[model samples]
Target: MIRKELLSKCKEALTTRQSELIKQVQDHFGMKYEFAKETSGELSNYDNHPADTGTELFEREKDLALNEHAEKELEEINEALHAIEEGTYGICKICGADIPNERLVAVPTTDTCVEHAKNETFNRGRPIEEEVFSPNINPDEVTDEEQVGYDAEDAWQEVSRYGTSETPSDFYGDKEHYNDMFPNSDENVGSVEDLENFLAADIHGKFIGVAPNHDKHEE
Candidate 1:
């Protein structure tokens, strides 16, 4: 019940923030559009002033990007509001824990915790050197075409003159192995078995079925 109250409060605050941002975006677009159009009109009557037209185009382009980004944010906030209505608000998608109050306050539209945020990923699906820092020389120059390079295996072979053709194991898969070693820390504070007893089969009208961690954390 307390958690639900907190969730509602957080949602309300986010609603307010989103509303404010929406107003700001609308005002910006409205003001910029009028300014650009007025400038263009004034330029059309001028003896010779190409700079005004250029300025208008620049403002339109800049506003276009801002509008796109703001629209995406508005959609995300709407999704978060819808989630709150559907009664699945504060849960982290990655770990299934109740995300911290601070995080919820900071990013109401966020589906993951600060640690699991999309921007904070450490090891992507691809391996280290092979993934991003690919070799094949020509580092002195760059081309605009494809920005990819050869695999780390080839680079290692070329540099060391000794290697096998076997592919390296992928360490970034979403496999469910090695889960038993680390229970959900947020849920299992004391004896894990006792904590398991506290988790409910139904979480605030949300039914996540048959997952081992879900069973472990159900109140």
Candidate 2:
């Protein structure tokens, strides 16, 4: 059983906090909820530069958010006070277990025990995509039987040569450039082998002269 003296102490703490929050909201953010133009002391927003207006609007929004948070905390304090009056101050609402006096001392506004209060038992659940999708997807590997060679993976690599969502950090090895970020990026694109790119052949399948790959031969 929780000591009556502790309840009295908690009630005192809650009341003090409630008063402080009310004063803070009144003093710091009393006029924060007013119209932007009125708060800014401007005749019209139309005369203000866009950047100036944006900064003022951001400040006003920040003030309102702070006030809202204070008000919400005040509401919790009020509820805790009411629970104290109703003789249910130290009881956990979810499990009907007696909350430890230590927890009550730490957070006077909390009516639930730490376990339930933290929502650890609650099922926050997973995304719907998890039901249909596998966690791992290889950029170069493909499983489609009919795809054969030079399929979707090749097409994606071609497009990724321009740009892709994958960053250099995503690769296991060092990747210095955006074009080098994709998997198997160094592989030949149009030809079966590297030699086939530069080696010319006649229309009759006769061997012709060698032409160096300008961009690749240098490396």
Candidate 3:
């Protein structure tokens, strides 16, 4: 049985916490309402820049998340008050043990003791989306067959060919010119096949040798 003095202390703490949470909920809802009113005027602007619209969307999402968190905290506080009325406020709901006085003072809304409370921490499970769509594969481990189709490495290479921010000065090794700045540029034949990599036909139907490292005029 809980001591009458400690029970009274717990009741005082719970009542104070419940009042604070109610005030917080009211404040969060007021902020949310004001944000909605402000954003309502921004929605009908066809002439607004894309960046302006993006900023408005980001602010709206932040307000929504804040309101949700405040609402959840208010719900927990209400549950704690109900537990106090039922005469089970300081008892650990999970382990059926007396929660320490210090723990109760620290977190008045929680009913679980320290041992059981550890299990309620952030979830360790992977998201369900990861099971459906796998993360990016290692670029080096990608097979030649995989390169033929739409692969992550292939997609990166295609985008890199358009050019990047890195200049010849930023290249790791000996880069004599701008062309040498690209990764494996000396041997980076654009095609999958060796023949296509070295040779290309002209508009006149004449085969032109274009191999960079090897002698094009070799007999």
Choose the strongest candidate by TM-score. 3
141-196 per-residue lDDT for model 3 (tens digits) = 43543566455554556566567767866767777666445565544445565565
The C-alpha stretches of model 3 lying farther than 4 A from their native spots are 27-40, 121-153, 157-219
Model 2 spans with C-alpha error above 4 angstroms: 25-28, 31-33, 118-219
What lDDT score goes with residue 151 in model 1? 36
Report model 1's TM-score to 2 decimal places.
Answer: 0.45
> Which candidate order results from sorting by TM-score in descending order?
3, 2, 1
Q: Local error of candidate 2 at 46, Å?
A: 3.6
Candidate 3 lDDT at 31 equals: 62
Write down the TM-score for model 2.
Answer: 0.51
Candidate 3 displacement at residue 200 in angstroms: 8.9
lDDT for each residue of candidate 2 in 1-219, tens digit (9 for 90 to 100): 779899889999999998899888776685534776578878788879989999998888888789889989999999999998889889999998999989999988887888889654767788788676434443333555344366555666677788777887788987767778888887765456677667667679787765445355657
Residue 169, candidate 3: C-alpha displacement in angstroms:
19
Q: lDDT of all the models against the reference?
A: 0.61, 0.78, 0.69
After best superposition, candidate 1 residue 197: deviation in angstroms?
Answer: 92
lDDT of 1 by residue, 81-194 (tens): 888887778887788777888878777788887777887557646656655554454352355233333433334434432323222243333435433222222232322364
Candidate 1 collision pairs: 198-219, 199-218, 199-219, 200-218, 200-219
